[model samples]
Target chain A: MVQAYILIQTEVGKASTVADIIGKIPGVMQAEDVTGPYDVIVRAQADTVDALGRLVVAKVQQVEGITRTLTCPVVHL
Target chain B: MVQAYILIQTEVGKASTVADIIGKIPGVMQAEDVTGPYDVIVRAQADTVDALGRLVVAKVQQVEGITRTLTCPVVHL
Candidate 1:
């Protein structure tokens, strides 16, 4: 499986809600509300890199209040 | 006392704008807008953990359009 760390930004005061919602999505193992440069941190997985990209674009990014996201794929090296 | 990677998210199409604004903040070493889970990533530091927190909360967070941030302090292990 391909694994990635998805960093998310939400509208101010909307982080906790966004994290909670993302945590329920399939393939998303965990989504936490955090304070710093990014509001939500998510760990997710898919069958391949392309699948991961699809999930990010098709599912995660579709969530409202999620202004932006960065997908850092885990590299074995 | 600390150095960190700040991952940021902004309203769609706001990534470049956010990065530009944050790059000018004091103590911000670098701010780059990238495609992924984080729209903008920043490297910064302060004398102590508290100062780092203060910089994040008082300064970085004050930037308009910055919805959330996550401070990943580099750890020596």
Candidate 2:
């Protein structure tokens, strides 16, 4: 499985809503709202890196109020 | 002196509130709500790395409904 952390930025007052919507997505293990530059942090897994990328670019990014996302795939040394 | 970004995730319907409160905390330079894997992203600084830790552990982490935090200190090469 490929695990990754995706950092999300939402609109001025839409963090929680965005997180809630994202948590219900497939492959998303956990989604939460927090304080910082990012409004939501998600830990997710997929069968391959390409799948993870597609998930981020297609599903996660389509949510309303989401402005930007940075995907950080877990790397094992 | 050190600079870092704190990624946070909170419970459902709590991202905006958490970010609002964290923005008022001392040393927090910026706090904004976002969508994706993390709910909030905060950029801040202190006189030292240890101080930054205290800020995160004592102040940022103290917010109610916050589930977890990941601190990423910016390293200069």
Worst 10 residues of 1 chain B by lDDT: B61-70
**Prediction 1 TM-score vs. true:** 0.54
What TM-score, computed on C-alpha atoms, does each candidate reach? 0.54, 0.54
Docking quality band of candidate 1, CAPRI definitions = acceptable
The residue-by-residue lDDT of candidate 1 on A8-39, one tens digit each, is 97766566678888999999999987655677
lDDT, residue A59, model 2 = 93
Candidate 2's docking class is incorrect
Query: What ranges in model 1 sit over 4 Å off?
Result: B1-77
What tens-digit string does per-residue lDDT give for candidate 2 at A4-27? 778788998888888889999999
lDDT tens digits by residue: candidate 2, B1-77: 78777878889888888888999999998776665677877778898989999999999999998999888765432
How many residue pairs in model 2 have overlapping backbones? 26
